[model samples]
Target: MNDQPLDNLDGDRDHATAGSGHDGEDHLRAPAPRVDGYAPLRSYAAIGDGRTVALIAEDGRIDWYPTPDLHSPPAFAAVLDEEDGGQVDLAPVDEYRMRRAYVVGTNVLVTTFVTATGTVRVTDSLNTGVAGRLPWSELGRRVEGVEGEVSMAWRVAPGTMFGERSPWVEHSPHGPVLRAGCVTVAVPTLGEMTTVAQEQDISGVFTTSPGSRHLVGLAATHDEPVHVPVPEDVDAGIDRTIANWRVWSREFHYDGPWGKAVQRSALALKLLIQSATGSVAAAATTSLPESWAGGKNWDYRYSWHRDTAHTVDALFGFGLREETHAAISWTLRTLRNPDMQVFYELDGSEPRPPRELDLPGWRGVGPVVDGNPAARQLQLGVYGDVMGVVRTYVDHGHLLDAETARTLAALADAACDAWRRPDSGMWELPELRHYTTSKLGCWQALRCAAHLAEEGHLPASPDRWAAEAERIRAWVERECWSPELQAYVMYPGSDSLDTSILLHAHSGFDRTERMSTTIDALRRELGHGPHLYRYTGMREEEGAFVACGFWGVAALAQVGRTEEARQWMDELLETANDVGIWTEMIDPGTGEFLGNLPQALSHLALIEAATALGSGLEGR
Candidate 1:
């Protein structure tokens, strides 16, 4: 993905000593100081060009970066293995402090580092091409002296993905090519001890004076047709990349409160979109544990229709019609049968079964598993989610083709027949049960389909769909509600409270009394200060689900608890990383981020909540 802030950064590669001099080529490893432990997951900022992402730590180390595509194996896996695959470092040689932010409305990350001597600003971006997505991936780092002189060192260390393949300097017509395994990177050879390759390493040390501009960049290829970008073109590519993001940002129509946060969330969600296929991934990284002393880690690189629908819905709210159409069209192509698969590869195929790893996870949490098995599970919520996008698309003055109409009709019938059966809920539980949210999803699906049918856009029997919706509603009210608990329970014949039920209020299902009571019941049962766990007894199984917390706020605002929602939102905003990126969950007590980052679902939920509270959609 050449063009989008396909963002975010980090690495851990075996060190290679730089072989001095380039008699046509040099192999070198500049000594990289070891960084032992991970900085808090909350300390990383996500930056991308739209095709790939890299997570930059607060201290100026790029801790994690998946190359070429979000679905590709990571080129930088330091965030996964600190001692083995660590980071590409660029910082002061002495004790230093730093500040970071996105450049206005764009995804270009500018981190300013201040040492005892002076300040040097690092501008990091995954450079996009001038027009469409880039033909290749490029990471552009420009260090400009903002104040007095400061000594800085920069190194290119291949991460664990390239442990057996440190960057080797080779002669190319384009100057010097750095090839490591299936990945090839081209960088400018200009610095003290320049163009040295040893143990397949390329690095340079330089000092910055006031007004001095030092640019270093990497052009990488992932088994694609390679067009090694020239150093001069690489510099121009950075300018164009920043310009492209700003140009895209102009289409955003959100003028609500938290405008910057909303835009940033939009930008992050933008990076997760698969430009070639038009699918949106759940998060940038997989296997970043969702809990400390982990047990719930799962690959989030694949696209979940449930999550993508939320993305599409939120993007539509921002007046980003292009994104909405792309996600809808791509997701529609993957629904082979009426029952929605929980997840799939960006190419609309089912993901392979998950495999376990023995490596230590972030913060010593082990059992990192990759490739999600959720693709095989029955997450009935996806029926409503997919139709929800269709609902919004029609609301925006677009007409669905006959194929989509047929799909909606089939889905309505599927929901009718399937709502009575037990299936995995949104959390993808293993055991089949009559989960309230699962039934509620089918209810919403039928209700949405019935609306389309009533409007004469679909061929479904509106009367039957309405009857089924009522039937599902009655079933949930009768079996899911717990008078003893004073709330809608997690599943039939259970008294456990579920935070997901908070969405029913927003969905206009059990609004007012039961929903408000559900909100109160869940808050008392599952709440932990500013955050809420996903279900009844998850206090220790995983971290706080940030999206559920925001969903709760939206429910509160919808129930006329505006001040309470505002108070909660104010606290949640503080949990965002320095560059305003968020993860899947949070450590409520320590405020540390838990799980994969630039989490699209969490950000989408944030937009939904803020828009609801700020625009009075909740109290409507």
Candidate 2:
């Protein structure tokens, strides 16, 4: 209900006038600019309906939206390829200035455009049906006239499945329906509107006066018959969607120092949770670029086992038992594969083998990808991630089912055998090495398994787990520690340092002198003004990893540097875009977001960092 400023919410001044125009309103009539046919990642805000997410640019262009699911091939992929990739644009015809906010406490977005002639407000949402998600996906946009009269233009253009399939409009009894591959979309409009269906897009223009309203909706389905939405029903659905989000938000109770940021993070995470299967995707989009220099982009639309414990802890902090239970159950059910692949598809299947797309990437970055390559890699640390989550559930006075207990025991036994092997560490790099953090992860997993067995929640060899855990710790101390750098190396006998080791600070790893000293060393070697690269030597390759910066915050708090952690947390909070959504990385020098957006790890880390600081203060 509160109208937070679109800019300068933190008291910073914006030079651009709200609705200002140069040359007597001529310049203000220009459409929002795009560089090389793309908006800055920071300019996009996400709207979703539990199953899929759409990214709307500040300019009122929906540049990215996948069909039935977040991981499906996108219908509007202008975020990746502007020319061939399609977009849906609805903005004033004349020059205008805009400001937007998430209708306060909801993912529903309201953007107000101020033009020379008049002002209008656009409300955007992915409509949800009553009792949960609808059988099909619906995207609704409502426009209301605020004052005077404004001329507005709109278009609905679905893409070629990232240059894979061609889309065409089929005139049906229900109006114009777009078909691409197995996906079908219905375009519906109201309030004196008639659209022209072209080869690949549908567009129309309308004028709005004071107190007038217009509506546009896209109802779509993959591999199913599409339902054409009624404009009045779509308008009502938008309001209902807003209400649903607000109701969910009310249940999330957090009153910490960064309460607003944490709340926004929770809502962002909510969008990434797939309601159908309870799997939490790592992000909403694929191949958004981790570095403008290109070559590092990877699809993050799949769920990673490594994020299980963090997601559960973050959800638990807000008393969201539904999401917490969903994440735990999904992880347990998916890991039954026994291979424990690093990540899985939302439908609990192995990811499609990664393949290069024919389309150009965001900002001309090439080799756009469709799937993640790390799914097959050996990530030894997953043992800890899985066991740690189950242990947390058990510690909350919940008993694990017999099947889950047996799975945990098997995972613990696997960890004991795998601790000595060199594999991809937490970073999922290509190189296999005796990563110090991977060793620490195994040690943490065994410790959790031991505790679970003692509580009768897991059937396992507690004595063997305890003895092996100590041996792993001793091995890490003897081999992974670097006397030359006075810190834990990335791997045994390597000079590089990894911020991933910071995670163990919360895993009950050593908080004594050596670990504390490594924190300072990491800050000196890898830190960039409260941000951090993933590891040593990454500064030249990519931006600072957003999650690592938050991990540093949690690490500082856990290592007993509360004041320093608070200061770092404050600075890091400002790094997010105006709406508090984060991508995988941040360009430290430019302060622009990079990589797939609304990242689960980054938001989860923020929650963990905030909670750590709060708990640290209470213990004092």
Candidate 3:
């Protein structure tokens, strides 16, 4: 809320102050590596203010930021199109080696740059207001000199929405402002520096001496009067944001295996949870290709019922009532309509059909999609997703309203009827067939419904649900198990194996000798190194799905192979990027990131796997 109009922005903007010195040196004399002007996905770290996230590369470039909200159009998106996409660069002018990490317990990033002349530290954050989230978004960069004097250069450039709209700079009484579409941005500088205003950007250079501190603030708004933040207030907000994140992180109660990684995953999931609503975005970005040859890109900013359920379950493990309740309540309220889609918009509305945008995609992976087509598919697993979370909610000593109870009963009845039909399954494949995982999900749904009815939380007939669950069990056992392969196949008759079957271990569906044997078959067929391809033919097209590997950890623990699960967990934890962020997939051979980043499902799976190992409890 430290934003005011141009009339109030007149002041001596020199707000330099000496701050604590940073320790650590990662030295390299070479320039940052780039291929076609794009940094490697593994080279990026993230900082956010709960409303939206900004991806910052190790070299100090603010790339791939969506304004106002996570799903909104980008205000800075050099990660996608490099040339036309906007970016904010703050780094040493000369060649420097850099290393970065989240400031211990918070999302605020600290990157230390070591040059031949001296060293400097850049602390970056999307500032939060005093009360809570701010109405206007502010990107704060605090530069501190740790050693001898070093020269630094910065640029604040707003893009044309990848040629969708044009950006122009307007000179005002206070300074130069960049306007593109509905977004208006003001770059305010503090400390000893010189700045130049051009047609499209504001450029600057400054020299920092030992103990000198400087700040660069970008205050922006969409469809509203832009606020030019006071440099002093922006500096204070950065400290306040760090304290706030630390306070939130303290409430996370995990002491299991890979505790640091688990907490990082939880923080990453928090970034995807929109504070305005309780909806959880599947990932932070869209159109980051799953395949290098293009055509696999899809938007993940929407909320899927399955993901919400998983998020609720993971939050519940940490005893986080607010997030768990908000997610469940929002999902149940959004699903009041009889027909359920695969996913919904973040604001509890039905999503529009997928549309491909006109832009050179990330590294020229074309057909950058804006919405998702999977919303139209009939994924029967959503039934299990809903019922499972409701059961967990009730188990946690919470009550369901009368309307929700009735609606769930109806959904249970529908699941009974739908399990017999072939549907798109969890993967949302174009060719619908009798997917074994989808059938298992229906079986789980009926079982949970019967349990709820017995506990008096539901009004449905328990007998019918139990009978249907038994029938599903018999059908899956009879047709889905491939005797020759000694494993459960993808469908009734196909010989292909899918790693999604590992999810059944945590679903309370099967943990018998057969299920244990199936785990071995899956690892043998799909695993490469510490990762697993999603299904039979995914190795031919994409990298191994990151979440599937974590699912294996939970499956192994569930089947009583604790030693194997712990060893596997150790190896998988090492696969995360330096900042503990994970993409949708990882190339097993090259260790490169793929697909959308800071993926919620991958982090959620990590939490679940850790909980499974620590508690030694059967899947709920």
Q: Please provide TM-scores, in order, for all candidate models, with all chains considered together.
A: 0.91, 0.95, 0.94
Of the pair 1 and 2, which is ahead by lDDT?
A: 2
| Candidate 3 ranges with C-alpha deviation above 4 Å | 1-32, 617-620
Instruction: State how far residue 588 of model 1 sits from its true place (Å).
Output: 0.6
- Residue 237's lDDT within candidate 1 is 71
Error of 1 at 432 (Å): 1.2
Tens digits of per-residue lDDT for model 2 on 34-99? 899899988878989999999998899999999877887888899999987888899999888877
In terms of lDDT, model 3 sits at 0.84
TM value for model 2: 0.95
Q: Model 3 clash pairs?
A: none
TM-score of 3: 0.94
- The 0-to-1 C-alpha lDDT of every candidate, in the order given, reads 0.76, 0.84, 0.84
For model 1, what is the error of residue 526's alpha carbon versus the real structure, in angstroms, after optimal superposition? 0.9
Model 1 per-residue lDDT at 327: 87
lDDT of 3 by residue, 1-620 (tens): 11111111112211111111124342333434778888888777777887898998777888788886787788788888889889999999988877666765677887778888987878888998877789999989999998887999999988877568778899998889988889998887879899999998888999988888899998989999999888988888888998888888788887665666777788889988888788899988988989888899989989998899999889988878888888888889877966788889998889988888888888888768889988989898999999998999999999999999999999999999999889998999999999999999899999999999999999877999999999999999999998899899999879999999999989988888888889889889899988999999999999899999999999989988877887788788767776788889998898888998888999898888888876653332
